[model samples]
Target: MNSLPKRIAKEIERLMKEPVPGIQAVPHDDNLRYFDVSIEGPTQSPFEGGNFKLELFLPEEYPMAPPKVRFLNKIYHPNIDKLGRICLDILKDKWSPALQIRTGNFVILREKVLLSIQALLSAPNPDDPLANDVAQHWKENEPDAILTGKDIVRFSVSEKMDLGIRQAKVD
Candidate 1:
């Protein structure tokens, strides 16, 4: 990896000094541009009580280009595919060079990628989904789909434990 950009370095430092609630993003020692992330499922959501693992990588063109982010663990959500590709607008055409990893109080909450993803878990948009089947399920039988999502999280957590994969801990 090349040297970290000044903007990214400052963002990383702020992330460490003033951590976001229920979210953690730690850069790997070998690659500062890559982060190992964990987001605790939002309260009152189907994903509640689950800790989701994800990977985020700031590409060479970073703020001008949105960071690449995807779930490392399986999650049953309409907007998230089996491969963990997210269908969030900010990660796509809405991306802007002015966007920051963490935003100030006045900024629109969804403008922050990580916060948007966390909010996605709380309010999934089945109408515009990345996983067609999951979206169909969500649209057809909403209650059942929610149950399935909760079950998938429980199963994934157990599987992680069986494999000795440590869950990320936020301070």
Candidate 2:
């Protein structure tokens, strides 16, 4: 039927075959419209050395409505909230159905957006932040903010890893 769900499944299949380096996303068998993704932190970024997880879900009205994407791993990005919601323009006000009509075009756009997100992690834009307090600190003192950001990133990720190890030991 080439419905939204079908198109998402097709795109996800192609992504699996030609996967991006350091980024992995695959459909959940129980929910083809929902994707489980993991992005390796980019080198030299504050998020570097941390393994981050994310989820992307295609809403029923997707293409007309932007996909719902959020970080599952704790991150300290100004553009991302503690709950994992992102404040990216393309995922918000800039979505257009034309971008997803042709499967090939959709693939390209998806890749581009992913790359842009990676870049965002490498160099956060404090001026356009979703986390207001973090943004304020970043704007007032850039160097200190970077340090604090890295500290938070390290702490959050390490805590998650520790919890995982504990669970493994318990089982």
lDDT of each: 0.84, 0.76
| 1-80: candidate 2 lDDT, tens digit per residue | 24445666567767878888878877787777787877877998777877778888878886678878888876777888
Which residue ranges in model 1 land beyond 4 Å of their true spot?
101-111, 160-171
| Residue pairs with backbone atoms closer than 3 Å in model 2 (clashes) | none
8-60 in candidate 1: lDDT tens per residue? Answer: 77777777777788988888999988889899999999999899999998899
- Candidate 1 lDDT (Cα, 0 to 1): 0.84
For each candidate, C-alpha RMSD in Å?
A: 4.9, 2.9
